[model samples]
Target: MSKQSIVLEPVRCPDCNQTHIVKHGKSAEGKQRYRCRNSECSRHNFILNYSYRAYLPEVQQQISDMAINGSGIRDTARVLKISQTTVMETLKKKTLH
Candidate 1:
């Protein structure tokens, strides 16, 4: 039997819902850089290279599901070991969808 590779999807900013992001450059620690195209967004440049939080794809999915499940932002953040700001930000972006 051969094993297949699973491609993890890239995540977008919670401010602007556009996936038209591209590499702007690299951070000092060599983390990937991203630029949002949504003109309404104040956060044009971002670092996708978090040393701890926001590294896992599953975590992002859970953040979405928790919001849909009526969980409080702080509650979700505590349970998921993420920042409250991240939770709120992700939920805010999810609303755009």
Candidate 2:
């Protein structure tokens, strides 16, 4: 009997949930990056996993929520274990949008 090869699943876009993805290049941290081909997709490029906790969407959302709930920069930073600058910047950008 001939040996069978293992099949791997295709990468799906996190934004549009599409299968039209292509390898872009490696990130500065040597992590793999992928690009979405869907024209209607708002996402430019994304990594399946991020090395930094501050870069995670959930963390960013938490930052915004905490700020809305009257949390100070120092408090948020201490709780999130992220930089004060990151919390401030995220708040600024989030408020602007």
Candidate 3:
């Protein structure tokens, strides 16, 4: 059997949509984080795998809708199948922005 070579492609920057990026560091969950090389890019670093439903756009919108609809934190967490802490954190971040 012959040995096969695995080719790895370079990751692109999500902020600037540029192909120039470098490995910044690993997250607490050991996920690889990348930093954009473009100095003008707003976002400095980002992770590929979010590993949380709260990070999703739909989930974010739902969190806002649930809050506006008078849904409790626990209720939103249950409906979204996410933790109550996650629900609270999502809402908190939204308010900060």
Ranking by lDDT: 2, 3, 1
Clashes of 1: 0
In angstroms, give how far residue 33 of model 3 lies from its true place. 0.9
Worst 10 residues of 3 by lDDT: 88-97
lDDT of 1 by residue, 1-97 (tens): 9999999786687567678788898877888888998888877887765776654556878988877788988899899998888888777766534
RMSD each, Å? 8.0, 2.1, 3.3
The number of the candidate with the highest lDDT is 2
Q: Which stretches of candidate 3 lie over 4 Å from their true place?
A: 1-10, 13-16, 37-42
Choose the strongest candidate by TM-score. Answer: 2
Relative to the true structure, how large is the alpha-carbon lDDT of every model? 0.77, 0.91, 0.84
Better of 2 and 3 by lDDT: 2
Whole-model lDDT, model 1: 0.77
Off-target runs (Cα >4 Å) in candidate 1 are 1-24, 33-50
